[model samples]
Target chain A: MVQLGRRYGTGPSSLAEIALDEDLPRAYLEQLVTSLRDAGLVVSTRGAHGGYELGAPPSEIRMSDVLRALEGPIAPMICATDDPAHLLGCDRSARCTVNVLWVRVRDAISGTLDSMTLADLVPARNITLDPRDPTASPAGVA
Target chain B: MVQLGRRYGTGPSSLAEIALDEDLPRAYLEQLVTSLRDAGLVVSTRGAHGGYELGAPPSEIRMSDVLRALEGPIAPMICATDDPAHLLGCDRSARCTVNVLWVRVRDAISGTLDSMTLADLVPARNITLDPRDPTASPAGVA
Candidate 1:
């Protein structure tokens, strides 16, 4: 996804190019892109120069949506799901105070996920730090 | 753990009792409790009336520690682990902005987990709500 984000405006990138750039198997990339396409996170073009591109700009794509598209609904436990469709509530919820704990946890996870976008992870938007210095912090970090 | 917390200071409760109360198999609960015991969250007594009990007050035990004990370290991704012993960092960390994203997510989860304790989940400390009413909120909820 990051790789795709980097090449967002360049044009549709072939799976072979992505695989080679990311040092992963082209077959694996193909499988992932299929789900991304189905989720409308990416769009595909067909022709001689056919390939895939982001469905929206990187800055507009929430990481939460990306993760959900790839991994299905966010669920920390079977009983605690963020999806309204699955909110039948757990059978033990009546007597289960633990349900609230998982709900809080799921909210924390979802909130964090919602707070960032693909742009936050794209190198162009991140403050570049000296790779060799683990303690180094950029003065201009915003 | 909640069972032991409820039974705290009362006396140790055997796994058989916990199994029946929680409607879980004794064998499964035994495995989970073993991890808890090794983490010093619970203590076991041996003899005719031997069983297990919380090692400390429920309020004193962080849910983060409980979860870490039952599971492993708090790691949203292999690149963003809380444990210093395993801080080799991913090879891609040098150029990977995604690391920070995972770190933020891990912190969100850990912060929420740390904010809660076992007492927060135990029924004795929770405001009892009407079991039949999903929308019902107790006036004394805190």
Candidate 2:
């Protein structure tokens, strides 16, 4: 979804094309697209030449959005989750020292992923980077 | 597996105890424990009072170690991963523009998790924050 959001923002794409190009299964991609569509992250057209596309702009799509759509929460620990009110069989939060660390890790992961938008993935301009030269790095040029 | 590692690290715990405490099924946990034991993260002891415990101390374990023992690499994008190479369909090193970003994110997550030892999770000797204050944030503590 993030890739599509960046690539063809508000444009349509055939499921088969994306699957073939991405080397993913068509059936699985189809189901994934359906879920994305339901999440309002994307829209799909059903007629001939119809396909899937982002419903929002690339700048509006965060990695967290895509991740939550696909994999629920990014939490590494259940006790460190946001929905602590619904905790089941685990009332040991008061003494759970590890919970604090997990919370930090969770927040850090969330913050980093949320900070990155789809637009970040698809920069407005082209760039160049030297891989072989240890000190050489990519420098953007118009 | 980190949770399991910490739990078992404290002491050998029965399957029923792990299930009740972790909110996971005994059958599923059995499979997970088997995998961990095979990976040397855990060791099993048999008999009426026997169960499983961490093979090593909390100080010796890293989150990455536990993660690799349970799941696999922590890369958000397959191409960003180090251990398993070229998993992502796109070759960012040679062509893709956004590959560096993925690599950076992957490294950041891994570095943070890997730097903290399991001992860091064991409750601190000196309580930095007031246990009574729900909103109290720890100060001068890492």
CA displacement after TM-score superposition, residue A43 of candidate 2 (Å)? 2.1
Clashing pairs in 1: none
The clash count for each model shown is 0, 0
DockQ of each model against the real complex? Answer: 0.67, 0.34
Candidate 1, superposed: residue stretches over 4 Å from native: A87-91, A125-142, B125-142
Best candidate according to TM-score: 1
Per-model chain A TM: 0.82, 0.75
Q: What is the C-alpha lDDT profile of model 2 across A42-92, one tens digit per residue?
A: 888889988888888878878677766777667767776644563343466
- Model 1 over residues A1-142: C-alpha lDDT tens digits? 8888988888988888888877789998888888989999999998878899999999999999999888878888878898878776767777677988888989999999999999888776434376676655533455
Model 2 RMSD vs true structure: 8.7
Tens digit of per-residue lDDT, candidate 1, span B1-142: 9888888877889999999988889999999999999999999998878899999999899999999999889998888888977766777667677888889989998999999999888875444376776655532344
CA shift at B9, candidate 1, in angstroms? 1.0
